[model samples]
Target: MRFVLKHPEQADVEKIESLDSVKGTFTQAGQFQVIIGNDVDLFYNDFADVSGIEGTSKETVKDLAKSNQNALQRLMSNLAEIFSPLIPALITGGLILGFRNILEGVQIQMLGQKIVDGALAFTQNGAPIYNTIVDVSQFWSGVNHFLWLIGEAIFHFLPVGITWSITRKMGTTQILGIVLGITLVSPQLMNAYGVAGAESINTWNFGFAEVQMIGYQAQVLPAMMAGFVLVYLERFFKKVIPNAVSMVFVPLLSIIPAVLVAHVILGPIGWTIGAWISDVVYAGLTSQLRVLFAAIFGFFYSPLVITGLHHMTNAIDLQLTADFGGTLLWPMIAFSNIAQGSAVLGIYLLHRGDKKEEQVSIPAIISAYLGVTEPAMFGINMKYRYPFIAAMIGSSIAAVVSVGLGLMANSIGVGGLPGFLSFNADRWLLFGLIALIAMVVPATLTYMYGKRVEGNE
Candidate 1:
């Protein structure tokens, strides 16, 4: 008997293998293969296939089970494992960033116009630079300010959202976690970004110690770790606290101290780490060695996405944009995304004669181009290695050109065609040229020389 179990647990595999009749075992795409000389009974349900007798005809069922059971679990277990939980927040944040980019562009255009007008007046009137400007409010009207605020709010409270997601994953009380998260990013707390200058002056006396009330707005690591720590605290409290008073004391004691510790310690430490990374990435990528830097990043960025380490780049991107006028590294990411999608499209072209292969490649191609590369990466490119290499070459070329042209986005997160909205208006044409190159190069190379394989199914 040869059977494939759809959702294979280690326990189930062990049990099947323990049987005297079992001869061999293998696993792939969420399937566990058990080969025996004769029919053997297995406790587990959802047999994907038994000697090519499929469980169902639906691809969705197969794909969903495969992704949940195989890809993520087989990868790294720490930060990478949490990428699944973080997906909703990531997609939402990326979409909302488009609005932020638009508002930023409007502000830049208005400020540039005002400065030019002020300069002309100054030249004629012989006034100082400071005295030349008539009104600062004219640069950003009330509506613009409100729209900008709306755009910033999502990113500003991202820590809260991440904390909420993490706590849910860790089996902590969602409301308590939310409360702790919100308190960390509260409007009452001093902004973390502004804390450096205020470190000398800002002080709060809490009887036990005098500490600064720094907020954790936009912090990623601290929020995620804090949520994980809350689980143990809640579990400890459940054992000690009296049932009648447990509700009030457990929540108060568990969250208040955690929040305080996070604010005083974790928040600042995460901020420093984020800042250091931003400095390194920005300085390194913008240096005279930029062409080499671009090529290296473009080559490795897609692989980083596969391991789920790309989330680390978000902090660097956010901080770099805040410190510099705009971000220079994000264009490399966009180019890499375009290249990955183009390679998938090339695979689709090569396999057009096979309906099954085309079916697999088309959706993966669409997803890659839309700035979500996992489908294409895991589903198609990883299966046939040469397409991935072709994509890296394309990404490298595009990244070098982008860096040479000094292309940048006002914000991070957006990529692919949607990324055009995030480009600096002055460099829009250069951005387009780079994206086009990224797309065409990989497609051409993959079609000409990259290895092609039939559908994995």
Candidate 2:
């Protein structure tokens, strides 16, 4: 970690240099720079004691944390507001998708297995028992197909739902956004997905510009963008047009321009951007740099949580699944979360004799293992210092190992124990083993550190 100190005094320079964790310090005139190679927390706490350093006071730290939260909240507020209404549908779709994947995995796993082979000799050439298992398999197979349809129905037309949601969020006419969204993905229009791939499809020139007609099924950014356009244009028309004719003219104007712009411009732009991110991430995951990629993300993930930047990974995970049928990052996040929980467990073990400490640590462990790390992180690991660092190390190791083992998740949600539902079933065992390692390594390291610090505390 590096930070600049403006107008630093001689005493301030001396104080920072005294900290052993400060790897390097440089100064030119009144400007000072310090690099902490390890123990960023120590630097933050110690440097705050310096006269000119801004964030060392308790109130400053609290305010800084709040400021970070507000910044992140504002960054995501609009998108989150739009998505909040669709959460139920998203949850339902994800659960069904997970169930379908699991059922398919079970069928594949049982393909070569023999069930009650001797029972077949006793009952009508074993047809009864064989038919029973076959029937069950077929039953699940049918159920999985239905579940797939249920999930796909929501996922395929997500653009429309999101558009409707956005319009509501923006306080605009929902009907116009809905119509724009439907027109974007309409089957009657040229297929948006396949248009670029096919050579036979021709572009339409509207005198102003030539645009290839395409649909927007399974898209999100375009729908949200069109909502923005509709909201602004609707407001404009409502302001300028007479109320007698405004209702019809506003909807008509909003629908036409919004759909046109989304289809002709924003839709393709968003698709290209999403596709580029997927390709870049895929390349990093597939290449030799993958281990480094996983380690960096895994190690820094906890810090991202503090700043609320972790939410951004959700989009990346979804895009990865869309392009590659699975996501490499979700497993890394799982390992990181598990590591934080294990670190809290370590802190708990160290304070075995103290009921108050144990009480705090116990729930933290549970919360972290449940894929919510805030309790474990702020409650125990961050407080202990060494445990947080140990957790980062453990998570980084596990992430690199996971990448090596080719562990991946089919979707992003239900991490920790329920993470199995998101995992690629073929490598479930491998994912579990890596997660276990992530837990054990951090717990052991933090426990050892805690033992040494126990009496001192």
Candidate 3:
């Protein structure tokens, strides 16, 4: 006799060939599985003599849950691997721009002329602008201009790095990835930044259709989608096409179609999706309910990091930076990082005498303060459940303050104590205030909570 198990919610029946197969599908729909027959042992002789079938079922469910969790962790790990190499370049660019902002945007008064004596001067909007570092020092002015070359290469050509990195991660053709990325941001195309105000965009007129000659500078989604498309195409071609001529035709076929698909279809779709997400997030940040939203987001952000969903914020931040002059979301992320670090610091203080705990907590605290929170989160905070809660509470309060005050960052930068360098010079004081809150609240709460928990124990 064949047995069938019906899922109550899904209303789908699964055919059970044996007890082993049923165990495999035990957790498919829900936590519990029921077998309704006195002849259950007849299905499997090995399980017939087993006395603890209920316990075995529970173990199977736990194993399935663990397997699913491992799968998710692997997915998140791969996603992080794609962007991990780009961090150094992004940080370097952010710091360079921050220094440039100090040089060019800051104003000082000297000798009663609103500037240094005999310095180079310029007029903007009919007002004489002066007293800036670049305005005063010729050497610094040259350095400022030089730094822009590196900055532009980092930000403007970011898609190239992303695509190349994707190909590297996916084990596809890296050279083809570089070529595909270049086509998206070619100088011959109209700059993506100027698309807003321009009266007309250049196009390629091919008798039947005209393709817009637009670039995808600083875009994240288009490059990523296009890179994967290229990877699959290369794989497909290599499988079918004989090895005798695979080298020449595989890359050629893979790149050309991928490029065409990117420009003609995927690029616009990706752009629209990215823009829509940015608009929704921007609306929330600027809306009347922004504080509430920030509170919820801040509290859950560390948890999101644990699940690896926090990686999506990179795309959103890049889109916000492309659409608006700056991103308001990243500063909140920085606050969360600080809050988690502070929680770990509290743990460190409580376990100062224990060398084993000190070895884990010290590095975790430093790593969290430097914008990477997995160490603190998993090693210390998550291990001590109360500390994680304390960090979340602290992050929520700091995020509320950040959104309420309208703090904005010029770009995504270091997300720890040094994160203030990424914010606008005008908002530095406000960022500092929130950073202090992020630190103090989590540490104080964790310390208090830890003491109570220890006392109870």
Candidate that scores best on lDDT:
3
**What's the ranking of the predictions by lDDT, best on top?**
3, 2, 1
Give the RMSD in angstroms, all C-alphas superposed, for model 3: 11.3
> 1-457, model 2: which lDDT tens digit per residue?
3333322343465575556554335431122335453366776676677746555453333333333234545466455557757756765666676667666654332344334644332345643322222335788768877777877667667788888887887788887778777887787767655765787765678898788767766666667677788789889889999999987798887778877788778888888887898889888877999989888888898887665567667667766776677788888888899999999888887778865566557877888887888667765676668999999999999989988777877766665656776664556788778888988999999999888777577
Residue pairs in collision within model 3: none
Candidate 3: residue 66 lDDT (0-100): 39
Models 1 onward score TM values of 0.73, 0.73, 0.81
Q: Model 1 off-target regions past 4 Å?
A: 1-143, 196-200, 242-244, 319-326, 450-457
TM-score of candidate 1 versus the correct structure, residues matched by position: 0.73
Better of 2 and 3 by TM-score: 3
RMSD of 1: 8.6
The 10-residue segment of model 3 with minimum total lDDT is 21-30
Give candidate 2's error at residue 223 in angstroms. 3.2
TM-score of 3: 0.81
- What lDDT is reached at residue 356 by model 2? 52
Native-referenced Cα lDDT, model 2: 0.72
Q: Model 3 segments beyond 4 Å from truth?
A: 1-75, 110-130
RMSD of 2: 10.3
**Any residue pairs clashing in model 1, and if so which?**
none
Which pairs clash inside model 2?
48-56
**lDDT-better candidate, 2 vs 3:** 3
Residue-by-residue lDDT tens digits, candidate 1, 144-189 = 5555464556566767767776667556788887887898788888
